[model samples]
Target: MGTDKPLIGFIGTGVMGKSMAQNLMDSGYSIAVFTRTKDKAQELLDKGAVWKESVAELANSADIIITIVGYPTDVESVYFNEGGIIENARQGTYVIDMTTSKPKLAVEIFEKAKARGISALDAPVSGGDIGAKSGKLAIMVGGEQQAFHEVKPIFNVLGENIILQGDAGAGQHTKLANQITIATNMIGVCEAIAYARKTGLNPSRVLDSITTGAAGSFSLSKLAPRMLEGDFAPGFYVKHFIKDMTIALESAEEMGLSTPGLSLSLELYQELAEKGEEDSGTQALIKLFD
Candidate 1:
């Protein structure tokens, strides 16, 4: 809104959030952060990002607030609860939720924020942890255009492709479209690698061949290798992917659309969650084929 950089309050310091916040700091924005686990906030704190004891404290002190927490329930708690972001944030402060959450929740937040003279955007992201660390995520934004324009500089620091999809909740709708595609593509990536191993072909060699062809995708290019190496560490967690797929399926059904591939992927991932692989990466879906 001015020549001086806006003070940013960042909530959620885990995995991707940590890197996204660091990038903003690197871009010369002052940051105040709050997270459930104090330990996770340490790296940003060490880098001179001030730590707030509560979400309200962070919201009150910051000119712009960005959150990328887990689950729709968590989103509600952070924004709607007493002593939460909406209750404590100053008038005219901008709130952005980058979490892949329910589109309905995003609209509800927009309505509430509007009543309070605040601007809210549902700006979910893709490209996983690597994207966050490298600042190349694809951000799909939904909210007022002016609000998005105000925050475009902040988004530029965190992503490569930033788009304003439409009014409140549209960004999350776009993200669900993204998750649906990734859901089915992940299954293809896993099964192809599993099939290669079964046929005594080199999976890596197969990857090199197919990754350049029509069979190529982000998961095939990035995660298929992790599956081969037994490196299941999370670039994006299995549980979170399940949450996203569930949201996608529900949204599709409500729109009278059928998403068989998404449903199948959700079924397989649910099996992984049942086996306690929820903390592992989405790449771990290959384990189901094994």
Candidate 2:
């Protein structure tokens, strides 16, 4: 930890979290990391991040805390648990949860943190692993305008496209909207490639033509190539996508919104998960068409 730069405590060094934490470390921030699986965080540890055995220890010592854990339940456990962030984090510490979680949970965290004199933000992100490694992620933040501005420098280090969406849970709502877009776009990308293969068009060349056209999308431009090469390794896991879509669907139902496309996408992904493809990448949706 440095005297000038705030001591940043990062919990969860999974696929995207590791890269995001590394980018911050490479940019010269002193980081303290805590993860359930220490082996998952060893790379960052070797790169000089201080390791804390638990979130409580990390929370007590660090000036700022950032988490990108697995799910909404994990988010709740980390922040509201007996030995969690709220209980141990120092006054005025800024805690940011980058997990794509329920909007209401984000709001609950914000209100609780505010009462305790801790600053909290729900700043869920998009752009996946590539964006995390390149620091080009699109970050949507929800919190007080003042806290958002205060954290802008940190956000700038992790992402190029950053926005203060609104207050408390607004960032999460915006991220849910993002997940909805990706869910349907992924299905379209898979169907287009399947069509291309059936017609004997070289999928790569087809991509070159269509990916820059009106049909272009992140899934089409990025994941389609991986699919073509039969690479189903996870950049963003299908299981996580299922979680995001489930949350989005539940949120929609709560508001009495009709989301036929989202509903259908959810069903297909759930089916894929049942086929034991849940751990595979979102690009693996192409397998469903076959």
Task: Report every candidate's CA lDDT.
Answer: 0.95, 0.94
Model 2 root-mean-square deviation = 1.4
User: What does candidate 1 score on TM?
Assistant: 0.99
Separately for all candidates shown, the number of backbone clashes (residues 3 or more apart, or on different chains) is 0, 0
lDDT of 1 at 193: 84
Per-residue lDDT value at 227 in model 2:
95
Candidate 2 minimal-lDDT segment of 10 residues? 1-10
TM for candidate 2 is 0.98
Please give, for residues 1-290, the per-residue lDDT of candidate 1 as tens digits: 78899999999988899999999999999999999999999999999999999988899999999999999999999999998999999999999999999999999999999999999999999999999999999999999999999999999999999999999999999999999999999988888888898999999999999999999788989888889999999999999999999999999999999899999999999999999999999999988999
Deviation in Å, model 1, residue 42 alpha carbon: 0.7
lDDT (tens digit, per residue) of candidate 2 on 1-290: 23488889999999999999999999999999999999999999999999998999999999889999999999999999999999999998999999999999999999999999999999999998999999999999999998888878889999999999999999999999999999899889988899999999999999999989999889989999999999999999999999999999999999999999999999999999999999999888888897
